[model samples]
Target: MKYCLSFLLVSLFTSCKYFDVEKTTSEAILKEELKTFNWNDVDTYPSFSICDSLISKSEKKECFQNNLSSHILKFLQDEVIVVTQDIHDTINLQFKVSEKGDLTLLEAKVDSLTVKEIPNIYELINNSLNTLPTIYAAIKHDQYVKTEFELPMVIKVE
Candidate 1:
C-alpha cells in the first residue's frame, strides 16, 4: 500500500502542467509591443509632390532624390555660380521634413573657404530649400513621422 501511494504521488506531481516555466509573461509581451522599428526598413520612402503617385518604393525614392538634386542644381545654375578654380569638395546637407509636409534646412557642411570665395552660397541654398514645395513625410510603421535626411553632394569646380 505504501509503495503504491508513493508511486501515485510521484506520477501526479510529474504529470502536473502547472510547473511549466516556459510560459510567456505580460512583461515579455509588453516589451515586444514596445519594440521600435528601424527607419531604414520603412515600407515606403518619403515622397515629393512629383513622386508622390509612384507605386514602387525604389521608384519613389529615386524620383524624390533626383527631383531634389535637380532643383538644387537649377538654383545654382540660375545663380551663375562660376567655378573659378579646379577644386573638388563634397557638401553634406542635413534637413528634416515635418509630418505636416513642411521642410526645414537644418545645416549645410560646405568648406568655409569655398563659402568665403563664393559669397551668397548660404543664401542661395536657403532660398532654394524654402522655395521647395511641401514634401510628404516618410511613413514608418504606418505613421507619418518626421524624418531627417543627409545628402552628400560633390562639387567640382573647373
Candidate 2:
C-alpha cells in the first residue's frame, strides 16, 4: 500500500510541469498582445472596406467606405513603404488569426532587405498588428469575421 501511494505522488508531481506549459503559436502571441489594449472599450471604432465577399453583404459598404478614409489609407500606405524599404526590397507579409486568439504572421518574404532590416520590419509589423484598435472593434462589431487576409503592397522610392 505504501509503495502504491508513493508512486501516485510521484506521478502527480511529474505531470504538474505539463499543466504549466502553454502551447501557443505566433498568431496567439499577437492576439494576446492586442487584448492588452482592451480595444472593445474604445469609442468610434476604426473602419475598413471589405474586399472579401465572404464577409456579410450588409457590412460591405461600410467597410469599403472606411477603407477610403484618409487616415486608414495613409496608415496602410506608410506601413507598406516602411516594411518593404526597411525589411526587404520585395516584401510580402501575411496576417491571420489563430484559433487560440493570437495574430499569426505567415508567408514573410523579403528579397533584398538587410538582415537588420528584417527584424525591424518584424517588430514594426508586430507593433502595428497589436495596436490596431479600429480593426479589432470592427471585427467585434460583426463588420468583419476572423479569417486570413492577404494584402499586397509596394514601396515606391522617392
Candidate 3:
C-alpha cells in the first residue's frame, strides 16, 4: 500500500510538470505573436501618384486625400452634365481598394433632391470611377491589403 501511494504521488507530480511545460510553451508562443501583431492599424496608408514622393505619414495621407478630391472634382466638372438652379448637395462616396490595387465603388449616397435635380448622378459617378486611374493598395503589416475610404462630396450650383 505504501509503495502504491508513492507511485501515485510521483506520477501526479510528473504529469503536473508535463502540463506546466505545455502551459509555458503556449504562453511564450502567445507572447511572441502579440509582439508582432498590429492592432487594427495599417503600417502604411494607401498611396496616390502625387503622394508617393511624400515620406511623412501625415503628409502622405493629406496628399492622398487632396489628390482624390481633385480627381473627383475634375471628373464632375469635365464629364458630368447637370442642369439645375442654385442648389447645394452632398454625396457620400464610399469605395474600397483591392489588394491587387484596383478601386471599387462600394456606395454613393446622394439625396433624393439631388437625384431629382441631377437625374444622371448615378451614371456620372459610375463613369467617374471607371475612368479613374489605377490606385495603389494600402499596406498593413508590410503586405498589400484591401482598404475602404468614405469621402463626402459637396456640390454647389450657382
Residue-level lDDT of model 2, residues 1-158, one tens digit each, is: 99999999999999998889778999999988887765433222223324454355446635633443333235545764433443324456676644333555676565544434445555655555554433432354444434454444453332
- Residues forming the 10-long window of minimal summed lDDT in candidate 3: 17-26
lDDT of each: 0.78, 0.50, 0.80
Off by over 4 Å in 1: 1-28, 82-88, 156-158
Q: TM-scores of the models, in the given order?
A: 0.73, 0.36, 0.75
Top model by TM-score, which number? 3
Model 3: lDDT equals 0.80
Worst 10 residues of 1 by lDDT: 36-45
The whole-model C-alpha lDDT of candidate 1 against the native structure comes to 0.78
lDDT of 1 at 133: 65
Measured with C-alpha atoms, the lDDT of residue 130 in candidate 1 is 74
Model 1 TM: 0.73
Full candidate order by lDDT, most accurate first: 3, 1, 2
